[model samples]
Target chain A: MLDLNNIGQRYGKKQVLSDLTHRFESGVSVITGPSGVGKTTLLRLCASAERPSQGEVRWCGEVLSRTPRAFRAGLGYAPQRIDFPEDITGMDFLLHMAALKKIGLREAKSQGRALLDRLGLGRDADGRIRTYSGGMRRRLGLAQAFLGAPDILILDEPTAELDPQTAGHVNDLIFEKDAIVLMTTHLAESLSGRSFATLNIPMAQAD
Target chain B: MTLFFESLATHTRIQLSRHLRSPAIWILALAAPIAARFMLPEQGGDYSIMSINSAYLALDPATIGLQLGVIMAVILTPLAYIFLRAGPTRRQPWQADDLTPARRTAQMLGHWIADTVSLWVLMLVLGLAGVVISLFRLPLSDVRPIVTLLCLCLIAAPALAVIAGLRTIFSTRRGLRGAGGDVLFFFVWLALLLLSSAFFATRSAPPILDVFGFAAPLAGTTTERIESLVIFGPASSGDVLSLDAWSGVMSGDYLFSRLFWLVSVGVLVALFAQIYAPHKFKALRPEIVTTGPPSFSKEPVPLASANGSLISLFLSEIQLVLRPRIMIPVLLIVAAAGVVLPFRGMVGPALALLLTFPFSQQAARWRGMEMSKLSALTPLGSSAVFVRLVAMVVLSTALCLPSLVNITASGATDQMLDIVAIGLGLPLLLTALGYLTRSAVTGRLIALILWYGYLNI
Candidate 1:
C-alpha cells in the first residue's frame, strides 16, 4: 500500500497541490482534473521522483524518501516526455531499464521479450529507438514501466501522442496488470468497464 | 531543516558538482600552483623582489601566490559565466513550470555563489599546497613567504569570486538583459573585474590605490626599506622588511577596504534575493500549457519526394544557417568589418568563421535531420555526417562570398588559398571535435586555444 499524508507542492509562488492526501491499494487509479490542477505533480510525488514541499509520502508504512532504494524498487514511472536516448536500440534500452531496476540479465532478456510482444512492439525491439514512431515510443515507455513487475506504476499521459490502436493496446496492458496504477489522461473514459477509482483534483485556490 | 534551506543546500551541491566536472576549471586550478612553483623561482618577469625578509628567503612566495590567485580567478570565469544562462533547482527541467519565479531564481543564485566560492577555496588550497610542497628543498624558515602569500590570496580571492559571481547574477536581473543590456553588462563586468584586480594594476600612492580598498589584501603593503630599491633582484642581506609590514591586518586602510567589500557582498546577496523571486517577473507566472495536440495525425512521406532526399536536408541545413534571427546580426558585423577595412586580404576566412557559428549552434540537427518516423526510416549513416559538415562549410563559404570576391579582385591568390583552407576546414574540424567530445564547449575552447596559439605565433 502507498499513501500520501497531506502532501503539497509549490513551484515558486504557484501552488500546484495543497493539502492533498490519498491512499492506494493494489489496483488501477485514474487521476483526472482540469488542466493545471497538479495531476502530474501528484503522480510524480507518489512515484518518489518528486519530493512534496509539505507532508509525507509513505510506502508500505515507511517514508518514501527515507527508504528511497526500497520504495523505488517497487515503483515504475513514465514521465510526460519519454526522452529515449536516440542512439540505442529499443531492446538495449529495455535491458538498461531492467538493470536499473536491478533485474538479472538472463531474466531481463526473457521478460523484455515477453513484454515487447505483449505491447505489439516485438518486431521493432531490435531497431534503434530514434526510428520509432510516436505511438511506438509511447509503447516503449509502457514497456520500460513493466520491466521489473513493479508494484506501483505511475504513468503521466500514457495514451498521449498515440494512434487509437496504440491507445487500445495501452489500455489492455493497464487492465491486465494487478499492480497499483496511477495514470493522468483525459481520454480515460475508454476504460469505463475496468474496476478503477477516479481522483479529481480541483483548481488550487490561491491565498 | 526547512525545505527552503534544504533546497538551497541541495541545489548548491549540484552546482558545485557541475563546476567540479568542468575539465577546463580542474586543469587550470591544479596547474596554477605548479606553474607558479617553477615559474616564480628562477625569474621575476617584469618586476623583481627587492627584499624578501632576508637574502636567504630565496623566493618572494607571496607575489607568486598573489599572481596565482589572479590566474585562478581568470580561469574561474567560464564556470561563473555558465550560471548566467539558466535557472537551477529543478527535477525535470524539460519545460518551465508554474513555480514562483523568485524561489528558483534565488536557489539558482545561491548555487552559483556557493559553487564559485567552493571552487575558489579548493583552488586556493590545492595551488598553495602545490607551491609549498613542491618547494620541499627549502627549509621551513626560508619558506615563511608562503604563509604571507596564502593569507593574501585568501583575502583577494573572496572579493574576486564575489565580484565575478554578483556580476553574473546581476547581469540576469530585469534591467540588465537583452542585446543593449548585454553590452552594458559586459562593459560593467569587465570594469569591475579590472577594479577587483587593482592589486596588480595600480601601484600608486593613496587616491588611486586607496580607492580600491577591496584589493588591499593583495597590494596593501607599505615597504619602508632602507635601500633605494628598483624593486629588483638580490638586495643586501640586512634588507629584511619586518613581519609587521607584510601582515594582512597592518593598517586601518586595509580593514576599511576589506569591510567595504564584505558589505558590498551582503548587499549583492540582498539584491539577488530581490531580483529572482516570483510575482515580480511575468515570465515566471503559473499557466497551464497544453502539451501538444490531443490527437496524432500520420502523413507518410515517400523516400523519392524532394523533401525526403539528402540534398533537401543539406539545403534545409543551409536555410537554418541563414535564418533572419541569427544571420542578420552576423551579416551586419561582416559588413561593418568590410566597411572598416574593405581591402584587407584576409577577411574571407575571418568572415567565414563568423557566419558558421549559427549553423554550429544548431548542433546534432544537421547530422540527422530531426525527422519524423516515415522519413527517418533509413539510418543517417556516415554519408549524412559528411553531407552535414560539407553543407556547413559551403554555406559558410557562401557567406564569405563578398570577401572572397574582394580577395580575388585583389589577385592575392596565396591569401585566398589560406582563406579556402580555413573556411572549408576549420568548421568541419571543430564540429568533428564537438562530436568526439560530445560537447560544443570543447569544440569552442579548442578553437579558442588554436586562435590564441595562432595569434601568439
Candidate 2:
C-alpha cells in the first residue's frame, strides 16, 4: 500500500495540496480533478518526483520522503512531457534507459524487442526516434514506464496524444498488468471496468 | 514560375524574420563583428596592422582579407546554420507547413540566398573598413578592386556553402542531435584551418627574405624579376625572371587561386548536399519509445572495481562532457587554439584561465543537470553527488594541466596558480548558484554573463 499523511505542498504562500491524507491499496487508481486541483501534484508526490513541503509519504513500510531512489526503484513514472534524448534510435533508447536502470544489456534488448512487438513498433525498433509519429512516441513513453516492471506505475496524461484505438490498448494493458497503476485521464470513458478508484479535484476559484 | 517566385519571396521573408528573431544570429552577425572592429585599434593607427602589413606586402590584401574573412566565416557560418535550420519549436521542422517538394526546394534555396547575402554584406562592410584603414597607413593604391572582390568572395562563398552543407548533414542523422553537429563541425573546420595554413605558407616568400621580399608584390612593376624569382623558389640559379611573369602570377593568376578554393568549397557543398539533402528535407518524427525489456532488473551488475556513488556520478559527468556533441568540439577548438597560437610570453595564469574558459562554459550545463531532481532518484546522496561534481570540475582543470605545465616551465608559476584557483573557484561558485537558483537556463545565463564580465573587467 501507498500512504500520504498530513501532506502539504506550497508554491510560495499559496497551498497547492494542503494536509492531504490518502491511502491506496494494490489496484488501478484514477486521479481525476479539474484543472489546478493538484491531482498531478499528488501523483508526482507518490512518484517521489516532488517532495512534500510538510508531512511524509510512505510506500509499503519504508519512508519515501527521504530515500527517493529506493522508493522510486519499485515505482515507474511517466511525466506529462516526457522529454527524451532525441537523437537515439528506439532500440538504443531502451538500451540506454536499461543501462541507467542497471538492467543486463542482453536481457534488456530481448525484452525491449518483445515490448516493441507487443506495442506494434517492432519493425521501427532500429529507426531513429526522431522518425516516430506522435502516437508512436506516446506508446514509447508508456513502454519506458513498463520497463523494470515496477510494482507501481504513475502516468500523467498518458492518452492525450494517442488515437482512440491506441488509447484503449494502453488502458487494457495497464489493467492486465499486475502492478498498481495510477493514471490521470480527462475522458471518463477511458477508466471503465479497470478495478480503479477516482480522486476528483475541483478547480481553483477565481478572485 | 510566378507562383514559385512568390513562394520563394515568402520563404525569404520568413527566413529573414526568423534570423532576426534568433539571439544567436544577432550575437554572431551584428554584435561579434562590431565588437571585433571596435576592439581592434583604428586601422591606420594600430600596431598590429603595421606589423602584419610589414610581414607580407604582395599578400597584404589576401592576408588581411583572408584573416578577417576566415575568422568571420568561422564564427558566422555556424550561426547562419543555426538560424537557417533551427525551428521555432524544438519538435517542429523549419518549414512545417510547406511539405511539397517544390516548396521545400524553394525554401532551402531561399534560406541559402538570405544567409549568403547576409554574410556577403557583413564581409563587404568589414573589408572596406579594413581597406580604408590599411590604405591610410600604407600605399595600397595599386591594390586591384578585382583582387579585393575576389578575396572577399573567396572567404564569404565557401563559408556559406560549408555551413549550409553542415546543416544538411547534421539534420539527417539522429546521432548528430544537440551539439553533436558541433563536434563534426569542428573537425571539418580544423581541416579547413590546416588547408588555409598550408596555402598561406606555400604562397609566401622564404622566411629569410620574408621581411624585405614581402614588399615585392606591393612595389608593382619594377620588381617583376624579383617577384618571378620569389614565386619560383626565391630567385634560385638559372631561373629566367620578368615583370610579366611575376604580375601574371600575382594579379590575374592570384584570383584563380581564390577561385580554385571557391570551387573546392562548391564541390564540398555539392557533395554533402547530394548525400544529405534528401535526408534533411524530410519530416522528422519523434524517436523515443516506451517499450523494451526492463531498463533495469532486480539484480544489479557486479562491478569489477568497488564503485561508489561518487565514482558513478563522476563517470556520468565525464560521459556528459565527452559525448559527441557541441561541447566536444568546443573543447577541441579551445585546446587546438591554445596549442597553435603564439602566446609566447604571456603569464601562465592568464593562459591557463583562457584555456579553462571553454571547459568551464561546457560544464555549466553539467552543473545545471547536477542540481536536477533526477539526482534524487540516483543511488548517490546529494552531498556525495555534489562532491563528484566538484571532482569533475577539478578533472577538467587537470585536463588543461599540460598547457599549464608548459606555462610553468616557461617561468610563470604565479600565473599558473592564479589560473588554477580561478578555474576551480568559478565552477564551484556556479554550482552553488545553480542550486540556489534551481533554474538551469537562468543559472547558465548568469554564469556566462558573469564570466564574460570578469574576463573583460
Candidate 3:
C-alpha cells in the first residue's frame, strides 16, 4: 500500500500538485493529466526517482524517501523515454538486472531466455540492441520490469511508442500481475478498464 | 561462409565510414604519424644507417609486434563501443536488425580487423618511404634486416587490435584511460628504454652514436657484430635451462616473453569477446531524477529536512557521471594517450589546448542544460538557479582538482593553466552568449574557433 500526504510540489512559482492527499492500494491505477501537467513528475516521485517539494510518501506505513536497493527490490519502474546501455544484448541486460536483483546466475539465464522467448525476441537474442524497433524496445522494457516480479510496478507512458497490439499485450501483462500497477499515459484509449483509478492533473495557470 | 564474409564486409565498411566521419580523429590517427615521419630528420651516413638497422634487428619480434598491436588496439577499442551503442543514440547509421549480440560482436571484430589492416597499410607505406630514403644514403643490402623487422612490426598489428578490443570490452575504461593497456604499454616502453641504455652503458658507446646501428638488421661490419651479439645474448649461455620458455614463465629474459604476452593478450581477447553481448532492445527505465521543481516560497527548506531527496539527487548526479554513455569513451580516450603524449615535442601545447577546449564546453553545457530545464518549470529567479548550478560545477571540478594539479606539476604548468582557463572560462562566456544569441551551437562554434586561433597565435 502507498499513501501520499500533503503532497505539494512546485516548479518555481507554478504549483503543480498542491496539498494533495491520495492512497494507492494493491491494484492498477492510472495517472492522467493534460500535457505539461506533472503526471510524469508525480509518477517519478512515487517511483522514488524524484522528490516532492512539500510532502511525504509512505510505503507500507514507512515514510519512503530514498530509492533504496532493498526498496527498489520490490519496485519495478519503466520511464516514458527508455534509454539503455546500448552495447549489451537484450538477454545480457536481463541477466544484469537479475544479478542486481540477486537472482542466481543459472536462474537468471533461464529466466532471461524465457522472457525473451515470451516476448517473441528469442530470434534476436544475440543481436545488438541498435537493431530493435520502437515497439520491441518498449516490450523489452516491460520484460525487464517483470524480471524481479516486484511488488510495485510504475510504468510512465508504457505504451506510447508501442503498437496497439503490443500495448494491449502490455496492458494484459499488467492486469495479470498481482503487484500494484501505476501507469501514466496521455492516450485515453490505452485505458479501457476500471481496474485503475485515474488522477487527472490540472494545467498550471499563466503567471 | 559467403554470408559471414558478406556480413563482415558490410560491417567493416560501416565501421570505416564511422571512423572517417570524425575528421579530427582521422587526422590524429593517420596524418599525425605521417607528419611526424616527414618532419623528423633521418640519420645520415652508412654507419648511422647500419647502427639503426642493427638496433631494429636486435628488437624482439614479439616486442615490436606487441607495441604496434597496442597502438592499433587503443585506436579501435572505443570505436567498437561507439559502434555498438550507435543505434539508440542515432549518432551513426545502424539497422534495427543488427542488434543481436553475436552479430554485434562479429561486426565489432570485423571493424577492428579492418582498422588494423588500414594501420598496417599505412605502416607499409611509411616503411617503403623509409627504405627509399635510406637507399640514397647507404647500401640497401645492409638494411634488409631492418626491413625484415619492419615486416615483423606489420605482422603484429592484428594482435594489437585483438588485445585492444578485448580490453575495451572487459575493462572498466575502454580507450586511452584504460589502466590495463596503458600500464602494459608504459612498462614495455620503459623496459625498452632501460634495456637500450644498459646495453650502451656496458659498451661505453658514444653519445653521438650512429643512428643506423639502432635500426633492425644491422648492416656494415661493426654494427652487424653488435646486432648479432645483442640477438645472441640470450642463446650464448649454452644452458637452455637458463632460458625461459613462453609457457612456463610469466616474465623474464627469454624468446618466450613476447610469445607469452601475445598468448595472454589473445586469451584476454577471447574472454572479452565471449562475455560481450549486445542487446537488441533498450529497457526504458528512469534511473534517477537529478533536478526537481524549485520551491517558490521565500522560506528556505532546511538541508536536513530534505536529506533523503538531497542524497538521492547527489547520488543520481554521481551515477550520471558513472553511466556508461559518459564514462566509457572518456576513459578510453584518456587511456590511449596514457599519462601524457610521448612525443610532447613542438606540438604539445597546441594538442593540450585543443583537448581542453571540449572539456570546458562540456562543463558549461552541462550546467546550462540543468538550468534550462529548471527555468522552464518554475518562477524561481534565474540568479539563484545559476548560483546552484555553478556550485555543482565547482564541486565537480574540485573533485577532479587532484588530477588537474598533478597534470600542472608535470612541467606543463603554463599549458595546464591555459587549458583550465579556456575549459572553464570559455564555457561560462559561451553559456551567456548562448542566451543572447539564442543559438547554443553558434555560441560554441564561435568559442571553439576563437580558442583555436588563440592557441595557434
Q: TM per model?
A: 0.51, 0.50, 0.37
Better of 2 and 3 by lDDT: 2
How many residue pairs clash (N, CA or C atoms closer than 3 angstroms) in each of the candidate models, in the order given?
7, 19, 54
- lDDT by residue for model 3 over B1-457, one digit each (tens)? 6766677788667756655564534444455345324322233212211122234222222223222322233233333232222211123333353444335445555555555454444445434444444444345454443543343343334334443444334332234222233334433433433453443334443311211112111112122223232321123322111111111112222223344444454455445555544332343332212133211122211111101222333332333333345654554454344344521332333333333333333333323332333222211222322443353344334433444554655865555544454435544564465453332333433444455446555
lDDT of 2 at A110: 68
iRMS values in order, in angstroms? 18.1, 8.3, 18.0
Per-residue lDDT for B168-226 in model 1, tens only? 45544545432233334344545655565554445443413332233444344544332
Residue runs of model 1 more than 4 Å from their true location after superposition: A1-207, B1-58, B79-109, B132-140, B145-152, B167-189, B193-202, B205-259, B277-313, B325-340, B343-360, B364-378, B381-389, B408-457
Model 2 chain B TM at 0.49
Query: How accurately is candidate 1 docked according to DockQ?
Result: 0.03
Candidate 1 vs candidate 3: the lDDT winner is 1
On DockQ, the stronger of 1 and 2 is 2
Candidate 2 error regions (>4 Å): A1-27, A31-71, A80-92, A102-133, A149-152, A160-166, A176-180, A199-207, B16-23, B26-67, B74-98, B114-162, B165-457
Which tens-of-lDDT digit does each residue in A63-83 have in candidate 2? 896666676656667666655
* C-alpha lDDT of all candidate models, in order: 0.56, 0.53, 0.47
Judged by DockQ cut-offs, the docking class of candidate 1 is incorrect
Ranked by DockQ, top first: 2, 1, 3
What TM-score does prediction 2 earn? 0.50
What's the distance in Å from true for residue B377, model 1?
Answer: 11
